[model samples]
Target: MDTLLANITYAGGAVYIFYILTAIWIIAKKNLKLLSIIFPILALLEGLFIDWRWGRIQDYGENAQIVLGALPSFIISIGLPFIGFYIHHFITQNLPKDPMIDSLIEKSKSGAFGNDDYPSIYSLLESKIFEKSSYQKAIQNVENQKELINKMIAVLTDKKDDWDWKFNMFNEYKVVFTLYGTGGSYDPDNGTITLLTNKSGGFMNYKNPANTIIHEITHMGMEYSLVRKYNLPHGLKERLVDTLVYLMFKEDLPDYRIQQMGDPKINDDLKSANDLESLNSIVSKFVNK
Candidate 1:
């Protein structure tokens, strides 16, 4: 314990690990020039804060000072992610224009969903992929909602009328209707929203795919950037998304409701539309604790 505590590298790797991950994030975000400049300043401030805190440690218990030093590191931690998410609100992203909404919300007739790639839990329960009639009918029903769904998505987006360009880390978003899955899923890596067109909508208040599309779109908007980052419980993730959706779109989709899936505890942070705006930082606070 003493050896580890004595070595800053041993006990304070968070700031360093933060540096590497942040560099990757800045590079991936492709705003190297601006973010790179700010990062150095933030890093310098963090270093000074840590140094000052470390120096103030009592002669007998250096660990006390070390922990104090670590406290300010969180400032930089908070600063950078806030910058990233804030940029999303102001920047004009590369999402599809209207009329191109079809391109964003199109149909998938292919029965070969590479079901093996996903877990058995995500696979369809009652219907098979080869159910051509079900698949096509599902596709048409989903497409019919594309126009209204596109509008409802505005509230889920960064701007009133714009789509979340980097939502789920994918630039372009599309929905895939298949007879295989139970309800719906949004894949962040590929920007694909998969919805089960099966007649048997098993759970999560999934009466139909139209509302389910909005739900998954909500998930796509938040999944990686917020939910997974905090290692949030699945139930909490669903609840937060459901709350955001209900707060933003319950009137448009009258049947919309927050299913009893997520941790009711998270409700403390997500009661209104105002809370939705600061969701990233709010969730970020979880790890700070």
Candidate 2:
């Protein structure tokens, strides 16, 4: 039926418009100048073609007419997404700018996650790179082992049944992977662990990311509570995570190589399993020392 065909075409056009807008926003955020210009032009041309084709559908009922009858429909669908590109140009070319803002716009264009200079987990995991290829396959392993990984973290951290509650986690924990970065990075707010998927002589055995997941999840539990509370430096935080993980999961995760990344000064004080029982108070005692 022409009516049904028109309906389907209309829906498809709506989806295409939504997708282009989302893409334009990303291009703007990522500061891809060429793509910003190209995408909107492409979207506009495609939208016009689609509108013309839809007009060809015979007996396209009153509903289609109301939506697609006027040139305004084409403008609304194609013009909105292009706004981000214009706004980006305005900010960079016309407005007062600083080094920090410039750095954010330019450095973000790299979109590469480096181990030492890691960005937010949101940026890394939300990246399109891991959507396919070796990284995608490796991330799947992490997902499958996520439940067991969280349980291991709960036990080693001694929170067990009340782990989420104890950590004050508001969301169900998530696990994802990045092809680069530290063995793992934790986003406490999102309760996510992004593991590096380089299995070539790297820590996470890509076949099984359980050890890496447990390590980062352990960080999530402490990040807000103990790490922030003590104002522990990055080195100290890494050291503390490993200390707890090793103390609790040494046998279960024999393959896990403790990176020993943190303040060496406090090493002798945190080697005992008994230390896991009163971790917070002990950390406070040693940290203030």
Candidate 3:
């Protein structure tokens, strides 16, 4: 009888070790469904095995002693899996949804922008109090500005399907051109792209506005997918956006401009590479697939 009990205890211990190793493997691979199934099995097996082994111990042979000592461990082991499952469920439930993209799709469905209309660009006039007429005058070159806008649209929409869904969401979305210092920005909250007209010495000065416009729009798209959808960290989000932009516009834009879009930490050589394979390898470290 003692030998039979010993064998049972040994087998249980072996199973427990296997469960621990499997749990680690599943966790490392982020196999959440498998983890959900395995953890409960682990708890059940642990409780049974631990109870049987403890039952054979002379100190825990008495019913009162067994209830006092063994019951707590069994309860704890069983409760742990329940707690783990709850945490897993809570995290998955609370994962971020892209509010920006959701709003854009809803706005599109409601016909906020006309069916055939594309995204609009508007010049933000400076407040009368801070009247700077030069900035206002820069945007007045309507014919030249239209030419630049059309060229940018052509470059960005070459493979229309790549961005058609996102662009459709922003049919009414506006790019607010401003003479507010250097660099452009996108506001996910309002679905607006604010381009710094002063960056290349205002609208008339841009040799190619497509470079900057594409960069800012890339940010807008990534914010919807990566930032809002996946809830990626800021550093990883920037890396992915820069890598994608580099891939898309490598032919049209200068190497330096592409490098400027990437994370400053990335080696300049890698960021400026003409090949997509090298660039993708760098981006894959932060984002799988």
Query: TM-scores, in order shown?
Result: 0.48, 0.49, 0.38
Span of ten consecutive residues with least summed lDDT in model 3: 63-72
lDDT of 3 by residue, 1-289 (tens): 0101111111223353354345434544555676667766765665455445444333321111101010111111222333454455332211112343234334545545332322210111111111234234333432234444444445444543443134322322234444322244455543344444432245422455455555656667556644565566655565656665666556655541433333555444354424333543444453454
How many residue pairs clash in each candidate at the backbone level?
2, 1, 0
lDDT of 1 by residue, 175-283 (tens): 5443332345555543445554443422334555557767776786677677777787776787877887788877888888887886576678777776666677766
Ranking by lDDT: 2, 1, 3
Cand. 3 Cα-lDDT: 0.40
- The regions of model 3 sitting more than 4 angstroms off are 1-129, 140-145, 151-169, 203-207, 259-285
Q: What is the C-alpha lDDT of each candidate?
A: 0.48, 0.48, 0.40
Off by over 4 Å in 1: 1-131, 158-171, 199-204, 286-289
lDDT of 2 by residue, 1-289 (tens): 1111122212223433344344434544644565556555655554455445544444423211111111112212223334563454332111212343234334445664234322332233223222334443454454455456645644543453333224434224444333433344555664544455542423344356677666666787788778888798776887888787777777777776655566676767667766565667777878777
Q: What local lDDT does model 2 show for residue 236?
A: 82
